[model samples]
Target chain A: MNPAFENITSLRAKLAARDITPTEVIEALRARCTQVEPSVSAFNHLDWDTALREAATADASLPLGGVPIAIKDVIAVKGQPCTCSSKILKGHTAVYDAGVIERLRSLGAVPVGRCNMDEFAMGSSTENSADGPTRNPWDTSRIPGGSSGGSAACVAAHEAIASLGSDTGGSIRQPAALCGCVGLKPTYGRVSRYGLVAFASSLDQIGPFTKTVRDAATLLGAISGRDPRDCTSLDQPVPDYTASLEQGVKGLRIGVPKEYFIEGMDKDVEQTTRQALDQLAKLGAELVDISLPHTNYALSSYYIIAPAEASANLARFDGVRYGARVPDGKDVLDVYSRTRALGFGNEVKRRIILGTYVLSSGYYDAYYLRAQKVRTLIRKDFEEAWKKCDIIATPTTPTPAFKLGEKTGDPIQMYLSDVFTIAVNMAGLCGLSLPCGFVQRDSTDLPLGLQFIGKAFDEATLLRASHAYEQSTEWHTRRPVL
Target chain B: MNVEYVAKLARIDLSAQEIETYQNQLGSVLEHMDAIASLNLDGIEPTAHASPVFNVLRKDEIKPSLPVEDALSNAPKKANDLILMPKIVE
Candidate 1:
């Protein structure tokens, strides 16, 4: 195996056998970081000295000891600048570690640095990133999809063994799909959201971006379970995600939602996904065609509801609190106005205004309330479909990533990219995206992601299906020729 | 809504460039949202949060506070461990 291409499982075994020291692994990672990071733009922050120190102290017996992991900038890691890649939050340092960060540290997983992302996790492509765009490691001109673009890129480029990423709509999984990595978004409350900066509070959940499905689960096993600080977190027992990986899908029922194969989907993506389904059928899992009829309005309903919630949640970022504060002028309003005016990016401002408009007096019931009702109908559609199958599978993204500046000028076109994934969030379900295949498009090299969504709190089913798919294919093993 | 109507209602004086962009973007976005407006959601209880969380019970205990200096340490301009802001009022 190439020294730079070790997955979390292989890295753990090497650490146990003393074939690689924590210091050497960090050196290899730092070396890889130096080589590919400039073109990749995978990180917003780097602190090698701190990572080395932590790695040096990793317990010799822990499962993930000494594996360097990257954290999305939206997440807090005590004493680091958790900017969420926005100029407004520039120079703001966190006073505390996020819950997931603490858990990774407790397991001897060294947090290498903060990865880049869309400002406030607002955009689909990291092009909206204030830190500048995170390019596809496979093709520097194309996008590494956002809001967890940096995390996916870093994991894909082998900068870190795995990384932490937040998904509100398709943020984590979308980027993972584009970058050819595995990303999982747990059920709404499966992972703690206490320390995560809220984008759309109701839709946001944090999970992993890894090179393999099992690693995504292993990393999840470490950070999941109930936390007293976040009341919204499900108070359910945490299961060993890796232990259930071998639970064969011999008798599993997989539903391929026909609605996802809508018109205008890229021909290559459609063909590749169809090929994957045939393989799954040969693996003994029955494939059934299903429908998500309310899907047509999913994007419309989610846009209103997510932005409305985001508008309310982000209200706490005023200068009175710990975020970037504008210089105080005569009154409080001046401080707030100037701070927000200078701090927020155009996309964030756009969403905030859109959210504010939809939630205003006369528009409240007409826009926000109706979107809520549609959200229910969308969820009900899923509940009805689940009774016929064990899991739903589709292409994680409708198209392979476009050029960085391709859709930046059009926000609606950008929102359309989340079409296949956002409804899953609106329905409060769990989903995982893994690299099922790759395609050559637009003379640029980027991978299309195959997304498998499980019923609410049915992460095991998604993982089992994805693992079975991966175990039988070599797509997960391909690497960028950096 | 007219450009000025929204600008005043939102409490921000948007630049001419911003107004042009908003006029186009907001108009289209809202038009797309029109689909939901026509849905008959009669007698539907609006769902607030996707997850379940009950009345939170917290121990009403106080702990030592971060020194005033530490709390205000990141403030760009401060006085006596307090965050300093620009003067208020128009």
Candidate 2:
């Protein structure tokens, strides 16, 4: 068996036992990347030379020793291109390592591939990537989900042992769900955002995409903690996540929000989610009915606030300082106008326009301010639910992965893909998505994710419950046939 | 949806066709934003951040800066020790 196919825990054990050197493991990973590239196209830029050089001397005692991590392109890695899968940053090499990258290196992980993503993390489907879309491993005809599509696909297809992804309105968890892997979004401020390119500053967070729940915990522990570079990073001491993995979910109150079971959700997805809930109840978890009345308004509020922030964040790429530039004339205004128009993709342009409209003078109070007010209500909804339950459970997404061109023409349908997952980001809380069940669709079995939302800086409970649930289920064991 | 004006403010030039298409597209998004407009927001405080960490002031001290070579590595246009841009004044 290729060492690359092993999860981090198993691989680490083998490396420690002197059964395989890091070179052999990385070589196997490179082979897998070559084998899977034709079908998955998971990476925007892959550097095996740097990976091998780093891995050759990795300290085996470190937590992630000799592991190859596929990083979402939005995160900076010094001397490597950080394109964010857009033409705007075509030749822009990162000037320094992001906080996560520094942590990953300190723990002996080799940051190998630049995973593809929706341009500037704007779209739910990775079809927005200028390089091309990353197809789902379960069914190539379908999308892997995004804008962390490449991050999830790399882990799913075994191109990398694990990956790092940023979640801003479901970018990490949603794609991890669609790809049948474990993805965790730490509580806002639980992880530093200094190196992550801003999508929506208030909502964006860095997290992990791993093959196993334990690997998720390990990776999260390695990359998380306070970084002085990011002021929003929580100063709380990092918990030993691996210590609580075996803690059972008995006597735990699992809240099932009625709002997540919307009318348009797929029938099979609904059935599988309910069955998983039943299994949890059978495992001694007390299922409680809960109401988050402001759930429906979350999407409306998110679209406004995220775009408004994105507009301000993305304005730094005006053909000056760095990034791709189009010299139109001697006039600086002409340069800014033409460069941005030529550099950005359609979706990005549309969002900039939307953001500008909301923040404009006449519409500021009506749209931006109103959305912020609605955001307060949405956070309160989660706060109210917390009073009754230890953890809130929901289907990670409304349905399994859809066909490549399924909802591309209509942006609203695309936006609806993140309905269930966006609110967690709005409230700046942590959430986890792990495989709980599988639904056979179009002659292929697609994975369904179960999400557990936890309180602020309360990843311990989320990891505990998800670990228990994962141990009881065989869904994570099923791998897609290439 | 005045896409032309919005694009101008965003520093992007849009074609006539793009303007027309964005008008319809952004119009629908605006319609969705209108949903929040109808809600009663009388006593609610706007939540720009969900965390309780406020006014995070740090010591005003100098830190290690990026090397000059690293800082200018990705510049599209560079002269000796400085970034070059199009002429701004006549």
RMSD of each: 1.9, 1.0
DockQ of each: 0.49, 0.84
What TM-score should be assigned to candidate 2?
0.99
Q: How many residue pairs clash in each candidate?
A: 10, 0
Q: For candidate 1, lDDT tens digit of each residue in A111-207? A: 8889999999999888778789898888888899988999999999988889999998999999999999999999988999878999888899999
**Model 2's DockQ score:** 0.84
Q: Which residue pairs in model 2 clash with each other?
A: none
Per-residue alpha-carbon lDDT of candidate 2 for residues A247-327, written as tens digits (9 for 90 to 100)? 888999999999998786789888888988998998889999999999989999999999999999999998888988886
Instruction: Give candidate 2 misplaced runs (Cα > 4 Å).
Output: none
Scanning candidate 2 chain A in windows of ten residues, the lowest lDDT window is: A326-335
What lDDT score is found at residue B53 in candidate 1? 68
lDDT of 1 at A463: 91
**Positional deviation of A226 in candidate 2, in angstroms?**
0.9
* lDDT (Cα, tens digit) per residue for candidate 1, span B1-90: 454454444444466788788888878888887877767778776666667666868787887755676567666677766766655544
Pick by DockQ: which candidate is best?
2
